[model samples]
Target: MKKIYLWFTENYLSIIVPLILLLIWESCSRFNLIETKFLPSPSWIIREFFILLSNGELVRNLLISIIRVAEGFFIGVSLGIIVGIQVALNKNLQKSVRFIFGILRPIPVIAWIPVLILWLGIDESSKIAAISIGSFWSVLVSVVQAIRNVDKKYLEVAKVLRKDYKTTMLDVILPSTLPEIFTGIRIGIDVAWRSVIAAELIAASAGIGYMIMYARELFQIDIVLVGVFSIGLTGIVIEELVKVAERHLLRWNTNIYQEEVTRKI
Candidate 1:
């Protein structure tokens, strides 16, 4: 009980500050101290949220956005991991691709929107392409770095044990790089989600971004706020889920790091 209380005390500022600000905003809006037209009260936003919920409009748009993200994320991560491993293992491949990747990687994902719209039209394909483009370079770079940074001593030991390259890569190198690769995956998901939203805002007929855009056109600030908050809340929920998976999957790493820290202490 004491430990739990101490933990809450340590973390109280995070929760309390946000809560206080939200309360103040709600109060100001309700009292007309701040124009509700621009910044609606929390209650107005909640009411608008329920109105959208009852109409099923929010669900449909959210589903479309989620589908685009999933499709792009899976395909991008697959190609990134495979190519990254190949490039890491083969100097020739790395040399051939590195300059091209470096040149293209710095380009912002939003910059590709016009090109994708021209090529794929303002449809699901264009949105997915935007997300894929956004995710691919980041994942590829992270994967390559993770693979290259795997302990060379482990490879030497595997060779001494007469382990085949396939076995060594799958059992030793891949496992060793799992944490970093997953970090890349998390980044990929985040980038893909943002790119998807941007794509939807620019071109798509259906998505949370589209909903917000439409609300703005009609001057319904409450609906716009609902869409904005929904996007932020969903991102946070997905990020938390990723963190939980990371903790469970990387328990071995957590234990190892904890032991090292304890030794230093």
Candidate 2:
């Protein structure tokens, strides 16, 4: 009981508010405060979710969306990192490419879907294209900023040690910018997921966004709610996974201060 209490205390932000909202929603449904036709209770939504799952509709759509995101994220992040490093290290390249990015970056990912669809057709390729484009800019900008933010002192130290250009970049610049790169990755993944959903909503026959849109057209509000809930829950899980990976990869930097304190103790 004590452990349960402690766990609740630790996770209150993630738990208590959602529980309260669920209870309020359930109460509203019970009291007929809202028309069930428009807004079903949380319990009804949960039941619909299970029904969809058992029929494999939810799982199939979810898998399709995940695959699209994974493909786009991998491609976008790789290109972003490579291009960001190249541009950051070369002043002439940065200046040459600045205008192109300035014009492109402000455009919303959804706006690109029509163009992408025309180029790649209303298929997985089009969806992936939209996701990649949306995610790429986010990651590129972050990586450039992170590289630029690297300490001058570190550069000087590297020079003092007579490190070659390759060594300096790999050891000093790369390591110093890892935290910000990971931040970019997190942001990029979010952009990728959102773009994929928008693409699916626009054209694809299978995805969480498609599920929600189809349910809405059929006036199955509970199923729409289930799709929304599933999307939100999946996003949370993915973001948490990214955070865990970030912590693991950057553990040397994150734990250095803690290690020093421990030694003192």
Candidate 3:
């Protein structure tokens, strides 16, 4: 009993809350405290989840959503990093583009849905474009800010070492700005991921967003809950993957405590 308690204490985060919630949910459903049709029990939802999985519909839609997010996120982050770095390094370019970006950045992501639909039509292109736009500005702003805020002392040291522009940027500026850039990328991806539902809602025939919409229309709350759970769970997994990659790639920049934590894991 003591060993079991110790094990649970060590792994509390991964277990306790979920276990409590599941117990409460199951009890409520068993007692009919809540309408089963509207809010199915965890067991029923799990059953529906397995049914969808076995039929392959869930996997197919998940893959579609993942593909859309990847395409849009890649484009947005690539362009954002390149443009932000160029503008930050060149005073003249910064002056030329700052006002334009300032004017354009305030427009909300959803506002582009209509225009994208008109330009690209009600297809994958439009959806991808919307997600890309949603991610781009956030990443651009973060990259530009990170680069701009780099320590002048570091630049001076690089100058003293006779580092060329390319060398200075590659060895000094980029390394210093990496943490912020990673943060930006994470935020941008999150925005892009969330925007998938809205983008697909425009006219998508497949994807998690479409599945949720269809389930809602059919009043299949169990399926709807499954879709919502999938979205949140997928998002968490993606974010953790990005963080792990970042930790591996930028291990030198990580704090000592974080490094120790990683080692323990």
Top-TM-score structure, candidate number: 2
- Candidate 2 lDDT (Cα, whole model)? 0.88
In model 3, pairs of residues that clash are none
**Each prediction's TM-score against the native?**
0.90, 0.92, 0.88
The candidate that wins on lDDT is: 2
- The candidate with the higher lDDT, 1 or 2, is 2
Residues forming the 10-long window of minimal summed lDDT in candidate 3: 256-265
| lDDT tens digits, residue span 1-265, model 3 | 9999999899998887899999999999999999998999999999999999999999999999999999999999998999989988889999999899988889877788889888999889998888888889878988999998887866776777777888777777787788899999999989999888788766789999999999899999999999999899999999999999888977784466334323322
Candidate 2 lDDT, 1-265, residue by residue in tens: 9999999899999887889989999999999998998999889999999999999999999898999999999999999999999999899999999999899999999999999989999978999888899889888998999989987866776677777888777767787788899999999999998998899889988888899899889999999999888988898899999999988878785467335323322
Q: Which is superior by TM-score, 1 or 2? A: 2
RMSD of each: 4.3, 3.8, 5.1
Which stretches in model 3 have alpha-carbon errors above 4 Å? 1-11, 254-265
- Candidate 3 local Cα displacement, residue 217, angstroms: 1.5
**TM-score, predicted candidate 1 vs. hidden true structure:** 0.90
Clashing pairs in 1: none
